[model samples]
Target: MTKVPNVFFICGNGLGSSLACQMEADDVFEEAGIAVNSGHDSISDAPSLNADVIVSASNFRSQFANTQIDPKTKLVYLDNIVDKNEIKEKVLPVVKKIAES
Candidate 1:
């Protein structure tokens, strides 16, 4: 079997928003039959996480712009973190591709 991808949900602080988004993403992945190893972390911890995928609100785009992220890591930006439909539409495809790889 292929290894499950490690996905991290990033926010300003590790405490609130990232955790909430991670919870919602868990449900979305389960429904989509995608198995992932997921977690929540602050933006400061992002580059070091070495995740296959990193997800966060679009506002963090500028913050990540200056960071040296791994070329293989896939970033997914969402306008609404709790929106399942949006998550499915945006995140699922990247995850499917990563799984295939």
Candidate 2:
């Protein structure tokens, strides 16, 4: 059986922006028929999330780059936290690739 992809939506605090992005990600995953295990967490916790994909605001790229996050994890960045369409555009392809693998 193919493994479901795990995705993490990260933010500075893990309370507001990350939670919102998680909700948006859920919708995109559902529409794509992609079985995903997803969660929201602070950037500090990202190194330990064990996710296949990590989504975060564009500004946090430097922070994530400095961490010891798994080298295999695909990093996705969004300019707008509330733009579900953009999230779908960026993430669906990654999800499909994961499914194929």
Candidate 3:
């Protein structure tokens, strides 16, 4: 069986923005045939999530630099959290490559 990737959408808090992004991520991953176990979390929980890919608002990209996440994991910075088009553009290609590997 193919290993499903773990994708986490993170924000200041796990409740709001991250939740919105997670919804979009679900649809995007489903359409790409990239089976993913995804969810939302606070930025503080990022390192512990062990996500194959970490996604956050563009503004928070710098903050992840100090986290303990693996250097090989993909990081996606999005300008719009709820924009499926933007998510597809920034995230889908990387996910496809990961699935292939």
Per-residue C-alpha lDDT of model 3 across residues 13-61, encoded as one tens digit per residue? 8899999999988998888778888889998888888788888999998
lDDT of 1 by residue, 4-57 (tens): 899999999987988888999899999988899999999888889979999999
Give the clashing residue pairs of candidate 2, or none: none
> What is the alpha-carbon lDDT for the whole of candidate 2?
0.89
TM-score comparison, 1 vs 2, better candidate = 1
> Pairing residues by index, what is the TM-score of model 1?
0.94
User: lDDT of all the models against the reference?
Assistant: 0.89, 0.89, 0.87
- Candidate 2 residue 42 C-alpha distance from true site, Å: 0.6
Off by more than 4 A, model 1: none
Off by over 4 Å in 3: none
User: Model 1: which residue pairs collide?
Assistant: none
Candidate 3 lDDT at 27 equals 90
Error of 1 at 80 (Å): 0.4
In candidate 1 the C-alpha lDDT for residue 98 amounts to: 84
